[model samples]
Target: MDGATGFAVSALVNILLSLAGIALSWWVLQNVRLDLFLREPKGIQAKVLYILLSIIFGHGLASFLNDYMSWSQMLGSLFG
Candidate 1:
């Protein structure tokens, strides 16, 4: 992808990842008992942390996916 296209794609990926993170964090907080092993912050603080965690994880996953996809494209271009 060209620079502009790649930038746009990355932006979209970040947005999706952020949303996924929020959803995942919310579900985990609601369904799991984290207080047993962690400090277990409550209220907005807790939610914020979870959301942040999700965003970070999501970003990492997206990065890996992007890398793999790029590698695949490179290989295809070379071999096909």
Candidate 2:
């Protein structure tokens, strides 16, 4: 494949991998509910917390997988 094609494939794969992380994070959040015991406006803070948790969980899991499996290099190779 050409360099541009390789980079495009690598970028697409990376995006999908992160999305898998988000999906997994969503599944876990659905299974585990967190109650902050706050009223309406204050409750928005709780929602924010949930959003942050999902982002953290998603990125954290993705980063861990790449590091553990040494797939980061493979992905880098695609770009190179």
Candidate 3:
């Protein structure tokens, strides 16, 4: 697919993945005993860090997979 098509697909997939991640995180927080965010301070710094890290790890994984698959597809098109 072309770049635009790939971008559109990725955008849609990312939106869906984000919703799924939020739901999963909420479920885990409600049901699991991990207490992932309990230790975070109520200060603004902690809130900012939590938000940044969450975004990085959450969307970063999807972005990495998207880029990797694009490269793999490129290589396949070139060699196969």
TM-score to native of every candidate shown: 0.59, 0.65, 0.48
Write one digit per residue (lDDT tens) for candidate 2, span 1-80: 99999889867866777789977887787656476344653477877866777888998888787576567677888999
Per-residue lDDT of 13 in model 2: 69
32-75, model 3: which lDDT tens digit per residue?
Answer: 44335557466677656555655656565556666787799899
Better of 1 and 2 by lDDT: 2
Candidate with best lDDT:
2
- Which pairs in model 2 have colliding backbones? none
lDDT of 2 at 72: 68
Better of 1 and 3 by lDDT: 1
- Clash statistics: count for each candidate: 0, 0, 0
Which stretches of model 1 miss by more than 4 angstroms? 1-32, 38-41
Query: Model 1 Cα RMSD, Å?
Result: 3.4
Residues 6-72 of candidate 1: C-alpha lDDT, one tens digit per residue: 8899788767765675566566556666546556557676767666776676666666666786789
| Poorest lDDT segment (10 consecutive residues) of candidate 3 | 26-35
Per-residue lDDT, model 2, residue 3, is: 100
Q: How many backbone clashes does candidate 1 have?
A: 0
